[model samples]
Target: MTAEFTKRDYSLVGLDSKLAEEKGLANAEWYASEIPRKRMKELIQRRNGPAIRDTAIWFILLIASGTAGYMLWGSWWAILPFMIYGVLYGSASDSRWHECSHRTAFRTKWMNDVVYEIASFMVMRESVPWRWSHTRHHTDTIIVGRDPEIPAPRPPDLLGIAMSLFSLKTGPGEILKVLLHCTGRLTAAEETYIPGEEQHKVYRNARIWVLIHALVIAVAIGSGSILPLMYIGLPSFYGAWEQLLCGLTQHIGLAEDVLDHRLNCRTVYMNPISRFLYWEMNYHVEHHMFPMVPYHNLAKLHEELKHDMPVPYSGFWEVYREIIPALFRQVKDPRYYVKRQLPGSARPAMPGPAAAMMTE
Candidate 1:
């Protein structure tokens, strides 16, 4: 795969060459330019300032929620809210980790590190590894080898749903499955596949996240209830599931080809309720084109850009109405890449749900 597209090596896997040609790109600049002057700052924010107040709020909320969790651990349903808080507090704060990783979370470089470190701690998602993979993905959303988010094509089926649910590959699995692959140590599953220096960073921040989880497990065990892992894991898993499904619904049905953002990824015009849950991830195409824009700014861009969020079906509901039952059938069956490139063309072969989805 690396043999071709050697210049950027991004298009080697499967990204088509048309990613940069989409018409929706015009409004992204508007969202990026909202800060008033620096255009580059919109895409690559230089400020790494601390979001102290925001982090503090999430921290306090989680701590309080966990305390509630501790008290209500034994109740079958009591743990629900705690698990929700666990993933969401971390996920919400994840916005900051993302912001910082992009170097825009805080105003100072150190602040970027600080907020990232803290968000990393809360979420058990490390910074360095994520930073490395994300930087590449941020730059290229659909380039197969380059975009760490696009997965090799899978057979869309019940098994496909499971693989999609658990995979850490790029594409539809970005939020849930992908996070699992990157957050932990290099397991046997990843030992052979763990990326190289070009993909990983100077620091393998996996240790930081591991330690955080280790501490959580230790405390949970010490508390004498083996159920807290469920308390933490369930919600996190559910949140991961919700996030993953949301991601799949975003672009699964589009006639995707590598390197072609216009055809592969479509923008979604989100309703107020959907936006509340995702903070605007539903408008994926726009977000991908101009990632520096905050969630708050995505809708504004949508309004100004005039691009509609394409959901294949009617909306988020319709897409997911078909995906959930599918996951139950696919958890044990994993998808792999058969072919990733075209022989002579510059376009890359996108490994999406090619086999299963075609039949599907």
Candidate 2:
């Protein structure tokens, strides 16, 4: 934020609240520009190849990690770095699972499903539930009540109010939450699920996965002497931190909480640093606009969309730059706080062409 945001900086929020005033809900598309069909294609993933790659890499890490764990077992100190690598490896591949869930991991759908389920069961806590819920998020990005990732209001009670004001260390706080959730001492279900999915098949799938998780936990525990904790716990912690930083640094504060393009999401173009570390997710705005676009091609699509797309806003690092502030900030309700007009903020965008209807 101290980077001294500019007119271009404000574009990160694709739609502005004013558009809602210009056009009613049903015909909102008039308010925004369509993301080009050609551009969308560029972002789509050829996931099968990558899915296979992810599985192979992760499998190797897991096996090599166990050997490393046994060799370093007695030296509690040595176990520390191995734990870090295990989690980082798992965490990195976690996004690979995201690709699989969308069935973008492989050219063949069946292959994707088989591979995705295996990976999902290993690292994704609520695999099926996550798939269904996340699909909804893509379908309806920031739609206040609809999006699974909606930020809950700061609790109204006095203690809740007091706690909201205090800040915790960002990295460690995220790590702890993951650890606690993994142990079952706390349920992150609320952090993930909401009111509508109770009757869905995803609930059934989630239950089965949970049972499977019990087995994984048991195996992890049998390793004893905190070895299981190191193998599973450390990775879970690292993965959680990655997820938290990714979300917080990207979204933090921008537009209102509408699912429409205007307030929902934004994209970032790439620099070498972002491209390498984020794997092209730096084009956050473009990805939000065109969800089918794979992370690998997001940067390219962003460049193309720049001229034709009448974005509500065009800003970068909105989430990444303010990681610490976002962790402590309550980011809902007041919606967008704007001091000027820019990309996405210029108007509330109406919906674009309906995405190709997804089928299982």
Candidate 3:
């Protein structure tokens, strides 16, 4: 006789959340590759130069592209500049928001906060709420019902995944959440992770976001042109493809509810241009394992940890070749997952059953 299979609850307040507590997965200690304290300290040391230089270039590109798009408006030639602008605003801002939120992107506290808020808006995330949400993500990475940041939940919604490339599915929900927060309301799901003390900040930031968006829309209407919206608001929709492309590789087909970043997160090598846009988040396993390490230093950290970790994907194609198939298989067998293989030098995986019913 076949065993019954129930889909895992991915909700933060659902049955799995309670089960995780019972099973000792919530706030659990995870496996980390061994490294000497001095070497670890060196890798986590904060610096300003790399982020400063990269941020400057990012701003310059956005300005140049936006300017070109404005100049070429009403002509087919404008497509090129607008495309570049969209990617920079929509996609690149994701990494900026992520890195700055970790407070490791810059040495100066205010600089990180400044960029974090701006990038948070650009990425259509409420800064205060998402900061707390991501805190939960790190604390309980991929632990079902506790990780609020699982981009692609299982029995994978392939259509939703496709639509995310253009922000078709998530963009509306994000906008709705912003509008709801503007009215001083928080969704129950958000309230689960966001503390009561921080709720006011969420409302305040949402109002600010609404005001900025309203002003942009007013300018577009008064000027009788869609140009303003394109630069300010629409890019988050149109330019979302690259962000989705690289972001999916972070954990789409990896293990869930495991006490090991090595099992759940993936690190892949990317080209220089992709690295710049993603801000080196391709070193994702390293980031989750050592969240304090600055984006600029992830490569060095990867070298230090690679000997004791599973081999990283050579690039997007190689990684997706493994991921895409697993996602399809998951459509039929929700328990299917890509079980990562540790190298000989690696310590054994933490001894616990995955909270989800996973078949390697």
Candidate 4:
């Protein structure tokens, strides 16, 4: 028998766009749980204090880890420090890039810009293009052909997913994009979301990144050691595991082309350290539901909104248990996806062609 939800084109300039619009899924209003205006105002209020403290701690950890890794270089003692450094440099920077890009992490606009630029370079995301790409992501969520940040496409490349743990395929691909952008070229997909005016900024940021990488390589060559790269260019590869682990849980195995965050996004209860490192992004549903709410307030938002959401997975292991099998099944059945079972207390799933296509 044929699968019910056959794979469709996921690119922006494809049949899915027309399908999405016809089905009223393109730029549609998502269902958000009701909260008092006053309370939401407080929750969404941007503040410098929390972000400043968190950022200072993040930098302190990075500096301390880098120093330890350098002092311990060429010794077994280097392993732990380098590992910590890699997680901070590669994984944590991802959240910082995300939050700062939204310009909601810090009340000060310049502070957000400074952190966004630094974190973008660290995570290998082109600041300007990705900013627009993510804007499209928020505007369209997981509607196929619209959301640029959909991590797992149908008939998922399991090998690519595995390789991304080490940043092998993704790292090289992003570097190639950066190189191309440095020449003032944008990919066809990038052109879909990135405004023409912002193209120059993309080229500028890519050139700056190329120059920085060149300097790091030069220092490594001069010293006849890979130490410089281990600190700079290479950590993004070695230390990407944690970020991937947290990120994959966001939408993998979940419904797509749907307007409900509770259906498409997973919220796993994570420990304090994981929350810190992931920047509370594990509250995935809450983040998607109200993107403007700062990270520090996600937990409170989750508490306020949980009654209307599907029960969150207890933790990472629990979610992975479900996701791993769903992915394995999707390997054989490309149309398959996980349909989250919503609690009775939850609002009904939004009615649409996308919702009708989903199966539990």
Candidate 5:
């Protein structure tokens, strides 16, 4: 049950990184489901309409809920409005930041940039560092040393995962990272993925974020109330549960170091509300395989690819039913993973030490 032999270096600049490259796991071409060129083109085609409409609705909800929360302050009724506001501010923004980072959310480049910046602040991810970090994530997927974004590295920090549910762990760390960046410094690991040319942008963004946070603190001090922070600086921590809930299902229990996303990523059906907030990222395998497909078109793409892919989890409940236990098992057995089984029409799961067939 011990994980001693399976302990891995999860660092981007560590020995395992070189190992991954030597093993051809670094930026390697991956297995992808086949689709006709015409259909693939249609799926990758971006349109401004869906993103524009969704963004409008998102802003309207934020304004409405935030106004209600502000008006109802000093009363017990305020909690309800603020809860809605927090979800919109913290939870929904996570997906917005993600999609806009890919520039697939909106057809217009400037439009995506604007939302990307706004959502980045809301999610407390410094725009520049995270953009490069996420690029590494897509390139490496779940490869232990190469992927900078592996959420649940083996022998997973169970307490840390619990703290992240409310952003208790990640929020302060991100803020501290920004503070470090504001001093015109970059961590050695950050420098590995983020180019030297982009380093200045990271420092500049950190300073802006620190200034905005300082302004929020100043407003609360001047008013002799914490109401300002409730609207801005605090929601990212208080409303982070939804973000973690949707995000954990992406690859927590899946095989690592596999070339096929079908073996590592998850595709779960979600309710309409969760889908909206997560921006259809529950179709995570599809997104990882064909990142150019827009959020609005993931469902259609899922349909087209399902015949050639492993069976997707039916819903969040189904996904977690397996993930929760698998994580607990991994705490003692780091080699354990939920190996996916491909359909008869599809190719076998990629070869790896973690390879096995998981039945539905």
Candidate 6:
């Protein structure tokens, strides 16, 4: 028989949610490789040193670059420093937001919260709502109707994806959401994941963000220059490309509604600089497989679990080579996806109740 492809509904309010529940995909138990309890404990150990050091360097570079950009504002030289500043503000903050949100970045809970709040603001993500949204993401992964973070949905908006490289599409929409949240309102989809008790925090965070942006705009008006925004508000848009590149690789074109992370996630080898900037999230499969493990320990975790997982893509180029074409084909054939093949040496995917219930 020809390969079967069904038109899928991605909306939280749609039939996919009921179908997912019936098929045992919503809040399903996922397949995880067997690891000794002791070994798993060692990998999950939390520490403050690495995150503290990395965060310090990140802030220092952001400050230095912002200063240089400000000083060079009248000349073409401003471009270089601003670009550097934007990457730190927009891109680096994303990974920091992610790690800290998991509360795995720092040994101290307060430190993680502090950095999460700061990074959330920098990346224009409201802390409370996004935390819950991400919680659902981890629980349901790429399952249709359950995951709100699916980057390139089927019949993908190619132009929107291209514009998102610079945050042109998502940034404005996120800002609008923040503004709406400031009015103590949330969309129905957000309400699905965000608890009523936490809505207040979302509203408060939105107000703070709105106030900060307003203050920056006021400064720009008072000085008759956009320098304040360049250093603060605008970099989120300009410097978002790197994060987009990294984020898309996590699950784009991968299998959905599966219990196995190896089928749905990617692990790409990255250079030291990229590794540091991304906080080692390049080990996407490892992260999905065991999010409790801290970022510093993901490489070790990858080594331990690699035998059970699909072979990783060699690097970003390897990922893009597969992803770009997959995306192109998906435009015409929404049912098409990249199927990962495991090596002969790889262990079988862990069986779960959900596995038997998987829909075709």
Candidate of highest TM-score: 3
**Could you tell me the C-alpha RMSD of candidate 3 in Å?**
1.4
Show where candidate 4 strays beyond 4 Å. 1-5
Clashing pairs for model 3 are none
Which regions of candidate 3 deviate over 4 angstroms?
351-360
CA lDDT of every candidate = 0.47, 0.47, 0.91, 0.89, 0.91, 0.89
Candidate 1, residues 1-360, lDDT tens digits: the string is 122212222242333233333422211222121233454345343332225555565567667777777777667766576655745543554455666676544556787688677755444354555665566665545433434444323333444445534332222333343345455433332332236653344234544444555777897779886665654433444344444545565445343323334345545555664444455666665666566665555655555433332222447665555444443333333221112112242233323332233222
What tens-digit string does per-residue lDDT give for candidate 5 at 145-167?
89989999888888999999889
CA shift of 21, model 3, Å: 1.0
lDDT score of residue 59 within candidate 3: 95
Task: Write the candidate numbers in order of decreasing TM-score.
Answer: 3, 4, 5, 6, 2, 1
lDDT winner, 2 or 5: 5
Candidate 3, residues 1-360: lDDT per residue as tens digits? 156668888998899999888888899988888999999999899999999999999999999999999999999999999999999999999999999999999999999999999899888887998899999999999888999999888899999999999999899999999999989999888988888999999999999999999999999999999999999999999999999999999999888888989989999999999999999999999999999999999999999999988999999999999989999998987777888999998988873565443443
User: Which candidate would rank higher by TM-score, 1 or 2?
Assistant: 2
What is candidate 2's lDDT per residue for 1-360, written digit by digit as tens?
Answer: 223222211111224223322333222332334566665665574655654664676567667777776677788766665654555444544565566676654678887677667655445445555565676556545433334544322211233322322212232443343345445432334433434544344446555555654666787768665656555444554444443444333344544334345333545443553343344555566666666666556666766665544342233454345333433443321222321123652344443332111000
Of candidate 3, the 10-residue stretch with the lowest lDDT total is 351-360
Clashes of 5: 0
Each candidate: how many clashes? Answer: 30, 37, 0, 0, 0, 0
lDDT at residue 58 of model 6 (Cα atoms): 97
User: How does residue 97 of candidate 5 score in lDDT?
Assistant: 100
RMSD of each: 9.8, 9.8, 1.4, 1.4, 2.3, 1.9
Off by over 4 Å in 6: 1-6, 350-360
Greater TM-score among 1 and 4 belongs to: 4
